[model samples]
Target: MAYTTDFEKLKKQLNFKPDPTRPVSKQASKNTKMLFEYLKSIYGKKHLAGQQYLQSEEVEDLVYYHLTGKLPAVRGYDFMGVSSCKKTDDQVDRAIKWATQCGGIVTMCWHWYAPNDMDDYSKGSSFYYKTTSYDHKTCFDLCKGVTEGTAEYEFIIREIDMVSAELKRMAQLDIPVLWRPLHEANGNWFWWGNHDEQHREAYKKLWYMIFDRMENYHKLTNLIWVWNGQDKCMEVSPDTFDICGDDIYSVKEYDHSSQKQRFEYMTELAHGKMITLSECGYIPDPDEMKKDNAMWLWWLPWWREFVYKREGYKPVFDKDGYTVINKKYMTEDFMKRVMAHPDVIMREDLPWYDKDKHKLPDALSANLERIKSK
Candidate 1:
C-alpha cells in the first residue's frame, strides 16, 4: 500500500546511488506492473449488475463496478491506516460516500461481535447476543455462523432475511451492492473465525445455509459473493468456500524461508477464483521477487510504516499466480493500479438511498437515533 520508494534503501539494497529526484521503481517495477495487470485480468469488470434492486435519487452519474472491498481481501476500506475523526457510524458513512462519489465504495465493517462484554469476549461472546435482540442485525448472523447454538440462530436468520430484503430495495435503485457477510471467518478471534481447532465447520455451514436460504427463498442473487478470511488454519476447507478470500498479515512470514511452504500450499488449494489480499497492510521485502517488480503481495495501512518504513523493512510474498496490492503511503504511483482496480467493480444503476450514498439521509438520522435508544 506504499507509494513513495526509499531512494536510500534502494541504493543499499541494489547497492547503487539513490535516484536524486525520483524513487527507483523497485528497479524490478516491471514485475510489479505485470502482477497487477494479471490481477486486473482475473478481477474482470462486472457491468451487468444483475438487477436494479436498489434505488436512490442522489446519483448524478451511473457507473457499473463490482464493489469488492470489505470483501475477502481488504477487510473494509476503513483500514486506510488512518484513525478516523468520525466516531459514529453515520459520520463514517458520510466520509466513505465521498469515496463513492469518486467512483468507489464506502467499504466498511460492523466488527467486534462481543455479547457479554467480558474481558476477552468479543462480538460472538455472550456480550454481543444481549445487544442485537430486536434489531435487524448483521454482526449477529456472523456470530451465529461461527458459534452454533449459542442462542436462537433462527432470529439471526430472520434478521438476515429482513436485511436482504432491504438490500433488494437498494438494488432496485441501481446501486451496486458489495454485500460481505461473516467475512474473515477463517481468521480466528472473530466470532466466526476459522482456526483449525475453532469453529471451522460451523463457519462453512453458516455460509452455505445463508446462501441457500437467501438465493433459494429470498431470491437475493444480486450480490457479488466475497469470501474474505485469513487461512491461519493449517487445514483449510476450500470446499466450504463459495468464493475465494485470501488474506496476508505479516510480510516477515512471507520472507521467512518457510513462507513458500505455508502460502504455496494454500494457493494450490484455493482453486484460482478471483482472489485478492482483502486486508493488505504489509510492506514487501527487498528480495528476488522485488527485484523483478513482483508485487502480487498485499498492502498495509499507510500509517503503519511510521517507524518500520525507515527500518529497512521488506515485504514477504510467499504465493504465486496472484497479485498483492498495498495502499499504505499510497501516492500517484499507487493510485495507478487503483486506476484499473476500480474498473473491476460491478456498476449498478439503482437510486435507493443514493442521496446519502445508500445510508439514511440527515433528516432520518433522528429516527435512527430514536430506534437505537429504544
Candidate 2:
C-alpha cells in the first residue's frame, strides 16, 4: 500500500490551534511536562497510535509490528500484575524499557482487585465487582475505606502503597507515565463504579485520596493523571486530572467510522482539558476523524483477540496448530492504512525520543506554528 498526500491537504483544511495549557501537576517532572506539551501540540492535527500489551512479553506489539511494520507511539501497560500477585515488577520494568529503549510513550491503568478480598485467586486477579464476594451493601464501605485508623482504610492504603512504590521507581528514572486508575467507573464492571450514590461520592473521595497520597505523600511527580470515568456523574474534580477520556469498542468488526458522538460528549465532560479515545477496538479512520472534528489525542486498541483473530485456545496457536495473523476488530488493510496515515504519529515519529532534550523538536514546533497560522 502506498501512502497518500490527501491527508496533507486535509490537514491544511482543518484549523487546529495548539493547547497552551500545562499539566495539572504543579510539581510535575520535566519529562512529564514535555509529554503533556507534546500531546497538546498534536491535538486536532495528529494523534499518537497506541497498543496495549497484556504482559511484558511484547506479544501484542510484535503482532502489530508484524502487520504494519511500524510500532505504536504510545505503549499501554496494566498494573494488574500487582493486584493479581503475579509478575508484579515486570509490568513496571517493561514500561520503563519502552520509554528508555524503544523511545515510546508510556500509559498505565490499574485493574485494582478489591483490597483484602481475594475470594478466588484460582482464576487469577478479579477486579470485577461480581467476580468476588465483594458486597457494596455490607462487606464494602467506601466511607470507612477513606477514614483513617480503620480496617478498610488499612486495606486500601496497603494496596496504594504497593502501587506507589512501583510508580516511584519510574519517577526516580525521570519517566513520565500516563497513569489511568479506576477506569470504566461509569460502566460498573469494576468495584469502584456502578454503585449507590454514597458509593459514588466515596469513589470520588478515593480518587482524591489516591491523588493526595501519590502526589503529596509519595512525591511522585512523573504521573500525568488520565481520568476515564465516562459519565458526568462519575467525573472527578476538574483540578485532579490532567486529561479525560472515554473507552469505546465498536461491535461491528470493520466499523472505521469516527466515534464523533462519544468524542463530543467526552469533550464536554473534559471541561477545557484535552480528550482522548483511551481504549478502543476499531481505530477510527483518520480522514473520518478530521472530517468530524473529533481528533482524539491518542487511541489504544486492546490486546490479543481484539487485535488478531484467534481460532484456538491460545492467541498464537490456531485450531490446526498454525500461526494466526488474520485481523479481528480491524482488517489487515485498514490497520496498515491507519498506521501509514500521515496524521498518525508512530514510535519512530515521536519528538521526545532524545532522552537528553526537554524541548519540542524544531519540526514539531514548525508544525504547531503552521497549524496556528491556518
Candidate 3:
C-alpha cells in the first residue's frame, strides 16, 4: 500500500484543521500534510526537537544521551560530498535503521557539490565548490541536462539513482524520511545558490525536475519533500515541496521580531504548506517561540559543537592543548529540565509506526484528545 494512504488516513483520524485565513490545505505533499497534521495535533502541547550527527561514531552516544534526557526528538544525518565522489550508502542505511527501531524521526540534509568539480587543486577544497562563482551556470547546466536527457543526463541520473536506491530500500522496510535536499538555495554558499533571475528559474526547474524524477521515475513515495524558505526566490512551484524549511543562524540577541517576520513571510510563500525552523544557531527558548507565534514543527542545532557554542559552553583543551569535551553542554541539566516540560515531545512520546494499521498507533486518538484539552 502507498505510504501516503496511511498518512492521509492518520489526518482523518486526528481530525486536523488548517488555519482558516492562511489555509495550507491541498498545497503540501500528501506525506507532508499527514506529518504536519500529526505535529499540529499536538502543536502547543509538545515540540519536536532534532539534531544532526555527521558521523556514525557519534550516533550511538548521541542517541543514548538524548534519550536519557540530553537531546532532541529527532536524529539528523548528512550526505556531505567533501570528497571527489559521493559517499557510500552503508552509513545512511545504518542511521535509518537505528532511528527507526528507536521510534525517532529521521531527517537528512545533503551538502552535495557540483558534479564536475574535483579536489585536485587546493589542499582542502572539495568537489562541491571548485571556484569563486561555484553557484553559476556551469552547475545549473549540469543539473539541467537531466531534464533534457542530454549527455550530462546520465551523470545526473546516476547521482539521483544513488539516493533513490536508498529510499527504495527504506520503502521496503516502511521507513518514512523527512528528506531535505538542495537546502538553503536562497544563499550563495553552494553551487545551487547565488542565482540571478535566470538562475532562480533554473533552481525552480531543478527542484521540479528532482521531484518529478524521484516521484515518477524512481517511484519514491516515502519522502516528505521540504523546500528551503528564502526571500530570494519567488514562491516555488506549488506542488514541488511539502514543507517550507527555514534556517536561522543569526539572531544572537534573540530577535523575536525578526524571527516572526521570517515565519510570516514563509507562511505567505508556503500558501498552506507546513513551515519549520529546520536549523538554528541557538535552540529558541520554547517560551520565546510560543510568544512570537512562530511555532516550528521542529528545530535542529548543528550538533555538539554548535549546540555548546551557542549555549556559551566553553571548551577545555587537554594536556596536549587539544580541546576536550567531557561535558557536551553546560546547560545539560537545564536542557533536561526544559525537554521534560509537557510542551516538549521526546522520542519516547511518539507512537509506534503501526505496520498493521499502516499509520501511527491507535493511541493517537487519545493523544489528540489530550492535546485538545490543553
Candidate 4:
C-alpha cells in the first residue's frame, strides 16, 4: 500500500486530468496533482499575483486593499511558525487566516537555518550567503546518513522531525501548501547551496531525502513540491517537484530584458512544468510579463522593505516619502490596476477545492483532543 497509490486513486476518483502537455514531476503528491491540474486549467488565461508581508500590520493593509479591489491569487508563508531559528507562529497564523478568508492559495518557503550550531552565528546566514564557515560537505553527509548514527545525523534528524510535525499540522487544517525548501540552492548564500562539484549531488540528494521522510515516513500528502530554478541546480530528477521558479531581482526597477531572459530559461528548463517568480525585489508589471510571454503562475514580491525601496536608495521610513517614492517599485495604484487586469487572476478567481476531500480527519480530531487536554 504505497502512499503514491493512494494519491493515484484519489486523482482518478476526482477525475483530475494531469496535463499531458506539461511536465509533472513523478513525486507530485495527491494535493500537488490537484494544484497542477487547476493551474493548467487556467494557464495563460490569467496570472496570479502575490505579496509577502513581514509583519501582521502589513497584512491589514494588503487585506484592506484586496477587499476593495483585487486580492492576491496566492499567499506566501514562511515556516517561521515552528523553526528553532526564529519564532513567528503568531504572525504566520495571522497570514494563513487572511489567506483562508480571501480564498487565496498558500505557498510556503523555509529558511531552514544551518543544522546544529554549525552556522556562524556572529557573521550571518540570514537567508542566503554564508558569511562564515558552515561546512556544506560535512552537513550534507551527516543529514543524508552518509555518516550514519553520528551525533550530527541524530541532531539533524531530530530537527527535521520537528519540521515534519509542523507540516502535519498544516495537513490537518486542510491547507494545501506549495512547499519550497532549500530554495536558491545554486547560490552560495544558504549553507544548503553552493556545494563543490564533488558535493554537487548533495543538495539534490537532500531534497529527495526530505520528500521521502515527509511523505513516506510522516505521510504528509498535502503539499506541492517546488524546486529552485538555478542553471546549475536544474538537474533535479524528473520526480522531485511539481513546479519550478527562480527568484528575480534587479537593482533598478523591473529590468525587462533581464526578466525576460531568466523567465525564458526557467520555462525551458522546466520542461513544461509551470514556472513562477518565487521571490522578487520588484514585481514585474503584469503587462510586461505578458509582453515577454513569461507567464508565471504567480509573482510574489518580498516584504514592504524590499518591494517599496528604489534600486540603490536608502530605505525611508517617513510616511509621506514612503508613500510617494515606493510607487516606482509596486505602488497601491499599480497593484489596483494589475488586479483589475483581465489577464491577471486574483484570489476571488479560483475555483473551489473540496475541503473535506483534501482534509486529514484523523489528524484534525487528534489535534483537537490534544488542545482540549491542554
Candidate 5:
C-alpha cells in the first residue's frame, strides 16, 4: 500500500499546505527535519495515533495491538526516572529501540520533581504540587535558580545535566524527539504551573535556562521542542519551541468529541505553530475531528489504566508476572474501528516504515485479519 498516495489525496481534500518554517533548533538533525515535515504534511489531513507507557516496557503497546491490530505511530515516554534515579537508562534505551526497531516517533515529557526538597524516591517521585513539600506558594524562586552559584541554581542545573546526558544518547543515535518539558503548567497541580505573576516570570526564565543549556550549551540538536504550558502567561519565546500542545481529559468517560473548543483555543495560543493533543484520557474520534475540522497533529492517550478497564476483562501477564488489561476505555469494537479508519496513521502506515528494519509482532497479521473478518 502506498502511504504517500493516500496522504496526497487527503492533503488535496483538506487543502493542506506545508509550513515553511524549520524546527526551533537551527541545527536540527536530518531525521528531525524529516519528522517535522511529515508532521506538517499531515497536519490538517490526518492525525498520528499515539500511546504512552508509564515505564520502559511495551505493556500498553501489547494491549493496544491485542485490541486494534495496530501500534501507535508515536510512542510517549517520561523523564521521571531521571528524577527518581531509577531505571533512567532503560527508558532511554527503549525509546531508541522503538525508533530504530519499530519505525516509530518518540515524544517525551518531564515530570520534574523538585531538585533540592524531595528526598530521593519519596512518594514514588511525585511531581505534583499538592503531594510534595516543594511550596508552590512561594515557589522555588526561579530567579535565584537561574542565577549562578546559588544552591537553587546548582540543584536544577544538576538535574538538567542528568536528563541532558540521556538525551545526548538519543541524539548520538540520530533519534529526533518531541521533547516536552514542564508540561501542563497552566494547572496548579504541577509544581511548575499555577504560579503568581512574580513566579510566572521566573517560570518563563526557567524555560529559557533549560533551552539555552540544552540547545546551545549541551549542543543537543536532535530535540524538537514541544511547549505545553497550556497557558499563554507561561509561554516561552516562540523560537524556543517547535510545537504547542494542551492536555485534555474529558469528564465524561466516553466523550469522543473532536474537542473543537479546546483545539481552537490551543490554535490561538500556538501563534502559527503546529498544535497537538499532547496528552489525553479518551481518544478523540477521527470522524468527529474531520467533521469539526479540529485536526490535531496527533492525539496521545495516557498510560495503561487510562486506556484500559479493570472489570470484565481477562488480563495478560508479562514475563515478570505483571497483569496487562485488555478491556479499554473505548470498547474493543470501537477501538478496532478507529484503528482501521483511513484517517488514523498507525505504525505500519508510517512513511518511514521499512519491512526489514522495522520488525512488527507476528500476531499483528492475524489480528488484522480478525478485524477484516469482522
Candidate 6:
C-alpha cells in the first residue's frame, strides 16, 4: 500500500533527480516522515522504549578512560559483550531489574554475524580464511558456526523468539535492542564480500535466504538493520544493497582525499537510504582524510589495528614487521582529537549493538540527527 502510492512517488522523484543538494520533496518528506513516525511509534515506543531518550553523557569519558589505559565507562561501553567488570550475569540481571522496578526500559546489544553464506572466503575474514589464523577468523568462525549451525543457531533464534515471552514475564522492561549485523562486509575480505560477481551474488542470496529461514521473522520489522562496510568497496558499482550503511573504518593520516569520494559514492548509490558509522575508531589529523578526498574521515576500533591481523591475508604484515599500517605512532593527541568529535560516538551513526537486553535513546537520536543533518 505504501509503495503503491507514497513510496512509489518518492522513488520516482529520486529516479528523476538523485542529488543530495536537492532535498526530498514535501510530499515525499511527509510520506517518509509519517512512516518514520509510525515506525518510531511502533519500535521506539512499544518495542524499543517508551520515548526517544539518551544516556551516557560525556561521551569522551569512555574514550578518554580507554586512552588513559583505563577500562571503558560503566554506563555504556563497559561490557566486553554482555557483562560489566563488577557484575556477574545474575548481578547484571538484578541491576536491570532495579532500573525497571520503577517501570523503565533496560537496553542490550543485538548481534548479527556478517559476511556469511559464501562458497568462498573473503569478506572481512571468513572460516576459509581463518584456518590460516587471522584474528577475526576465530571469532567469525565461532559466530558463523554457532549462529548458522543447527544447535547453537536454534538457541540464538529461540532467544530472540523468546524476547516477547521474556517481556510478558516482566512488566518493568520495554527497551529495544539496537541489532546490527554483517558490518563492513563491503571490504573484499569477508565471505559475503560484494567485490566479485560470485560473492555479490551470494550476498544477496543470503539476505533473501536469511529472511526465509528465521523463526521470529516478525521481529525483523522490529529490528533496526545497520550495514557497515569499508568506503572503497562501492567503487565496483556492482550490486544493490537494501540496508543503509554505517562507515566501518579508515585511517586519519594517510593520503585519503578519496575517503569522502568513497562516502559520497556509496551514499549517492544508496539513494538516501540512511548511513552511519556503526563503530567509531580514532583517527588523528582527520584533516588529512579531508585533504585526501576521503569520506567519513574517522576511525573505528583502535583494536581493529590488532584485529586486522586477519586470516589468510596479511595486508599490514606483508613482510617483516617492516610492513607498515596507518600511522606507526597513534599518539595521545590523535586520540584526543577523535575523542572530541561528536561524530565519533553518535549511536545512530555508530550503534555498537541492539541486543543486550536494553538501549539508550539519546545515543540513538544523536546518531540519527547527524544523518538527517545537512
TM-score of each: 0.45, 0.82, 0.71, 0.74, 0.82, 0.42
| Candidate 2, RMSD to the unseen true structure | 13.0
Off by over 4 Å in 5: 1-20, 84-89, 115-125, 130-143, 311-328, 361-374
Cα misplacement distance, residue 269 of candidate 5 (Å): 1.0
Q: Write the per-residue lDDT of candidate 1 for residues 136-245, one digit (tens) a residue.
A: 22233344433445453544454456455654553443333344456556544455565445356666555555554554456553344445654544323333232344
lDDT of 4 by residue, 113-137 (tens): 5433444333322443334454432
Sorted on lDDT, best first, the list reads: 5, 2, 4, 3, 1, 6
User: Per-residue lDDT of 204-244 in model 2, one digit per residue for the tens?
Assistant: 77887787778767879898889998998897666778788
Candidate 3, residue 328: CA error in Å? 11
RMSD of 5: 9.7
16-110: candidate 5 lDDT, tens digit per residue: 23233778776888888999988888888999999887643445655677666668899898887785334454666677778877889999888
Supply candidate 3's per-residue lDDT for 226.
75
On TM-score, the leading prediction is 5
lDDT assessment of candidate 3:
0.57
Model 1 segments beyond 4 Å from truth? Answer: 1-88, 91-100, 105-114, 117-150, 195-198, 232-243, 251-263, 283-374
Candidate 4: where is the Cα deviation over 4 Å? 1-33, 59-68, 115-129, 132-146, 254-258, 308-325, 353-374
Question: Scored by Cα lDDT, where does model 5 land?
Answer: 0.75
Colliding residue pairs in candidate 5: none
Q: Given candidate 5, what's the lDDT at residue 360?
A: 62
Q: What is the C-alpha local distance difference test score of each model? A: 0.35, 0.74, 0.57, 0.60, 0.75, 0.34
Clash number for every model?
A: 62, 0, 3, 2, 0, 48
What would the TM-score be for candidate 6 when compared with the true structure? 0.42
Off by over 4 Å in 3: 1-36, 59-71, 81-84, 117-151, 232-234, 251-258, 308-330, 353-374
| Alpha-carbon lDDT of model 1 | 0.35
lDDT of 4 at 90: 56
